[model samples]
Target: MKYLFGPVPSRRLGHSLGIDLIPFKTCTYDCIYCELGRTTHLKDKPAAYMSAKEIKAELDTFFANHHPPVDFITLGGSGEPTLNANLAQIVEIVKNLNKAPLAVLTNGSLLWREEIVNALLKADVVLPSLDTVFIKTWKKINRPHPLLKLETIINGLKGFRRKYKGQIWLEILFVRGVNDTEVEIEALHRVLEEISPEKIQLNTVVRPPAERGVEPLTKKDLEEIKEKLGPKAEIVVDFKRPIEERAELLNLREEIIALLSRRPCVLEDIVHALGAHINTVIKMMDGLQKENLVDAYLHNGKRYYLIRKGER
Candidate 1:
């Protein structure tokens, strides 16, 4: 499962099975708030980062082993998925193997290209990021590659909206004092109207970010922004429902608890032992805490998750 990462929980798309198309940290923009840290490749051009055959093999193995109820087979991971040269081919292959909806998560840097837009036509949903509309704010927030122009990216999104018939859930990650300014939000609102996505998911930095300067907005601030963006917008920061059992997540939860029962472990410890994504681990930890099955305590200034004594 080199390319396939998870049937992990998601607040938007439940039980999303993630497929990593590009190599680790390879992307067009080195976003300030990326949880995966800085962009290592900083690539703009599309090339075959991973072979279609390899991805197809993984998909086959995954479905054969566990035909878990997956909401979406998301094409995204450590980097911009569009950069994978054989994106359309991979999508076609996956679609042949599964009935679940297909999705693509991208930074929207390459959407302006006609080829990229056409390639994504088969996706059931496309979630592209839009942090800011202004060039200065875009530069400051995304730190895009030199070849990626702000205007080009905006126009590309607009163009893609016009051409794409699938659901577009445009995401805007605002940092306090960065893109949350009055003028910035106003401009973004106007552009968002032009894009006219099915939904506008507002998000901010939550977990530890790549850069310390990146700050998250409070729920109060997020509510205000959602109001400004109109009825189509909603905050996607938190989840109220429990993770579905259909996601085949019981095993993951059991595994985490077993490791914690032996000894308390940090997020990294669970991830390393299980070879799971950090985001997935965080969500699992949140669910475990909500159920009072696990708790965290600071040890040597680092928080570690542990099984509750009563349960133990």
Candidate 2:
């Protein structure tokens, strides 16, 4: 499980199994709103952070257990995934596994590199973030490497749209009093016209962010912005996960604790695993939260439950 983290719940991709290609906080940009904390290394070059063999071996071990059905095998974790040098080979290996549709969550700063874009071709979906179209805002928000140019990145996305046949779901994370202005939204609209993503996902700071100044936008504001961005834009909402009776309430609580002892998971992931009623699960989670048995944090607009540090 060194490389694989979750068959965790994802609002966009369903029960997503996460693969951490790069080391923790190792990325091209150190954004203010990152939920995983600050980027320790701001890197632009691709290297074999973890060997393709190691990643494949972890995936093999995971699938051998045949845990449950997952909607996507997502390449994302504490850092941007594309920085891993053997991405293309790793994608092929994952494709061969055929456990689920492959997806990658990235900042899209590296898409300018033909190698990076080519490697992503095998993925079923590519979720890339573009917070701002203007360089000053981009620099302030993302704090990318000096080599990373806004113009180059935009052109790269446009180029990727042409070469990539897979679904491109473009994400825009708007922080209040930062990139949420009318002028910025208008600029984003222009970029969207060029990129033509399958879906334009509008997001904001929903978690305890890395910086104190990062503030979330109101749902009302997001709705208005979505309208401005046009028909393709939509807010990423929580999934209505299936709920069915299974074990007794006490047993269900034990199961949840056991699962979270290993890794964090979303409500839907817990529901799908336990087959318990969502209301029952919520009640249990609330009890755990009250008792400090578990904790919750928002990532990508979805609340995730995890065992508190040292509680396990």
Off by over 4 Å in 1: 239-273, 277-312
lDDT assessment of candidate 1: 0.87
Candidate 1 per-residue lDDT, tens place, 216-244, comes to 89889999999999999999986223234
TM-score of each: 0.79, 0.77
Across 1-312, the per-residue lDDT of candidate 2 in tens digits comes to 567866877778989988888876889999999866678889988988998999999988888886877899999987889999989999999999987999999999999998999999889999999999999999999999888899999999999999999999999998999999999999899989989999999888776577888988888999999999889999983322222222356688899999999889998889778776454576679779989999999999999999999987
* lDDT, model 2, position 175: 94
For model 2 the local lDDT of residue 256 reads: 97
Residue pairs with clashing backbones, model 2:
none
What's model 2's overall lDDT?
A: 0.87
Estimate the Cα RMSD of every predicted model relative to the unseen true structure: 7.8, 8.8
Q: Cα deviation in Å at residue 64, candidate 2?
A: 1.3
